[model samples]
Target: MSLPNAVDYSIIICTYNPDRRLLERCLNAVSLLDTAGLVMEVILVDNNSSSALYTLDYVQFFLNAVPHSKLIVAREQGLSYARIAGIEASVGKYILFFDDDNEPDPEYVQVQKRLHAHYPHVAAWGPGNVNVDFIEGVDDKLAAYATEAFQDRHEVQIGYSNQRTWQGCYPFGTGLCIKREYFESYALLAAKGKFSLSDRKGNQLSSGGDVQMVLYCISTGAAAGVAPELKLTHIIPGKRTKIDYLKKLTYGTSVCYSTCLLEIFPDHLATIKSQMISERKFAFKVLKKYLMLFFDPRPKKALKLAAYIGAVAGDYIALNKPVPSGVLWVLKRLKAI
Candidate 1:
């Protein structure tokens, strides 16, 4: 049922105002992939970057070096929109999404092909071994958290499951691989105005699209997993290593948590509602418990408090309810309102 010239994989790199050095390194790594006998295409989607990045010398050189490669300018300025553009343009059986800063190993494509053949039931999968290559050194206090943040599946095994949540089972956005058909379905939903999460637009770190995708996969009876053989290096710039950046990232994820979950798993409405209420209550308790700590000189305690505040805000937004007086008082006391 396959066309004679059908591509096996489509590698989609979504970027917006990317760092030139990081992009060059990413392109070089992609160019070195062992795709000798494999039919593949590289789709670099520029998500409303300020300049025409495809016209750059290094990018032009890369486009010439790789066969079946092209650049697409997504007028929409969001990772979700860029990825949807790539999905619509792809003709491969499997679609691989790599962030602009991700560098796949030489054997990445081959490993993915093998995994697809071996685990036909897995609709989405990601790299279990995601090494971080930080351009500059990080603070000693933030080093451990930064490492944990960047790496995926540090000690998890490779297997497929229908878990609804993305704790240890689902993949993130760094090097996410999925069946083209599944993504086509996702795109159709987006087209219908059902999918509205614009992940990481501009510099605002509102993220949930990847989690939505994983949950959608599970909802559709498809298994998702992580494979250690699939490897990639997530390049981290010095700016993202700062405590403030991490705090913002945490808050962003927390704020989008409830909305993403409810959107994908509507059938579990009652259960999710109950969970949200419990979480909101717990968040208030956490804020109260850390009221004094928020004033500490160290920013670490404030970061922890911000995550709980974000969760409470997310729940209130999702449920269409106003913040309770007590919670508002606590938030005000912590100067987080």
Candidate 2:
């Protein structure tokens, strides 16, 4: 069948000084794909990252022969800025946003292109991960080559998109592709400027801009889904995979939840509360199983536990006040999360 513009897609990696060796490997993965002329180009938006200062000495060295675009030291420091810059510079029929830490499957570009071609009504899509593992320089082909994972019972995966495929809250940010027209069509209502919650100084420790962007697309008339066929091995740092890692990611993600739900699904807080209470009961059943790890695991575990506690509290807080940060302010603002 005819594909979406026969591979007229652009993949962008919003990086802040990605190490040269690692960056090269990531570039090669996408550049060497067998998409004929379909995988048009890649954009490496350097977010003022001086990781490989010498990389600029030879632009072709880092870009590695593909028809690519480069943004040297994006003035804004946040990931959102880098993403916004990439979207602005893209000339392709579809825009794919990949993380610097990700090593995309060879089929990544082709799969997304196929779906967009077939489902002309869909506005956007996300990537799939075979499993969660993070180790540098380790050859991870078996882990990198697939389209499914077996998850623990308690952790739970929410917001399934059978028609969209893949996992994670509807459409995830990593390996996510959005039609540029979504931005152009809804910019007046969608706020196509940088991410919504990102501070001027780039402190994204507690916000979710990617989710905000897609929610905006949904708010408008664009359809979004997941493409399980387009896979990637998300590099979860050792430190980030620990029990504590979940807490921070979840807590930081809380802000994204508030920002997205309020704008996209105003009744999301009620759902979270129902989930927290329901999931907590289920989580408690598994609590006995994980008790050994908590004898005094690490601050990460403590942080994760704190974040869950914060999330349960945050949910109710967000119900009234739409922002996530302080409990007192939430009480004052009448927000739950």
Candidate 3:
């Protein structure tokens, strides 16, 4: 599990039965990175995919084809466990939390290294732009919102900018860069048992692992930044653009967000309680949006509204329930939810 001590950056790509075609594209992009002077290594962590990865001739051949890249199996199935394995096995000062579907620019590694050198206190940083790959035939309205949401980020500027906190910024796991020092010291603690309130589990869209790690790093007084020069392409498949999946993702995201919010800011519970709005107001808003979008006769628009309402309901449910600790934790571990 040990790596050479001289590696400057370790790109850890975690996957669990990922789309073979898209995974190849992601690996191809990594292999093409312009690393003329920088010392980097790509470590692919397999999260116990059901289809025995090693048995696949193409997967083995692909790993061998990529320079300075190797495949390591993380027996655990969760993304957090795979990430923990990668972080422990890596020997680089800087770590990149890359997903199997993300493709980085040619100079992505170099740009991240330069930014790390400039802002040593910033624990985790991401690229300035994350362009989504929306294929044809996807819902046009959903694709538009997805694209807009991806591009709307102000945390890490291109050349020079101050570090931002969780208050205003959140970088997804794709192409996210973190300092190994901070992660080893503080962020790892948040990933303890069942990795509670963490990011996307195998089939569940529930995600907050990245945010949980970021919040932990922020608590340690480390700033989060963004680098515009380090561009990355997020491959969004057609299935993800569907209304059903979007609704599930949004609901899971809200649940994870609310859980992490309580974990990271337990002291703010009283403040949150005081600031809570009436249920009637929430219902009124939902009814208004439903009425406004229902008669529009646009199926996509109706689905979008349904997804939003479902997510809001998930958020309200999570906000009222306290953090999962005693009985709730047991229920979660048993998949009773």
> Which portions of model 3 show Cα errors greater than 4 Å?
1-3, 149-156, 159-170, 191-195, 277-337
Minimal lDDT window, size 10, model 1: 328-337
Note the residue pairs that clash in candidate 1: none
lDDT of 3 by residue, 16-107 (tens): 98887678778888888888877788888889898867777767776777667787899966787788888887888788887888888898
Best of the candidates, TM-score: 1
Cα RMSDs, all models: 3.3, 7.9, 5.4
> Which candidate number would show the highest lDDT if scored against the true structure?
1
Angstrom error at residue 302, model 1: 2.3
lDDT of 1 by residue, 1-337 (tens): 2234789999999989989878989999999999877999999999988888876899899898888888988998888999999988879999999898999999999999888888888888888888888888778888777787676446356867897766675788878989988899988998898876878898887888988887788889989888888889888999998876787787777778777877787665676566566545665686566766746746667667767777867777667677666656655555443
Candidate achieving higher TM-score, 2 or 3: 3
Indicate the worst ten consecutive residues by lDDT in candidate 3. 327-336
lDDT of 2 by residue, 1-337 (tens): 2224344777788776554544555666766666664647667777776554334544466454555545445676777666667777767878888776666788777777678778776677775444444453322422221111111111132123332111354566767788877755433344553235551223334555666667666666556766556666665544444433344455566534654455556556456656544444534533532363358655444444445545555554455433333333322221212
Which parts of model 2 have CA positions greater than 4 angstroms off?
A: 1-7, 19-21, 50-60, 136-169, 185-195, 199-204, 242-246, 265-304, 310-337
**What lDDT does the true structure give each of the candidates?**
0.81, 0.55, 0.67
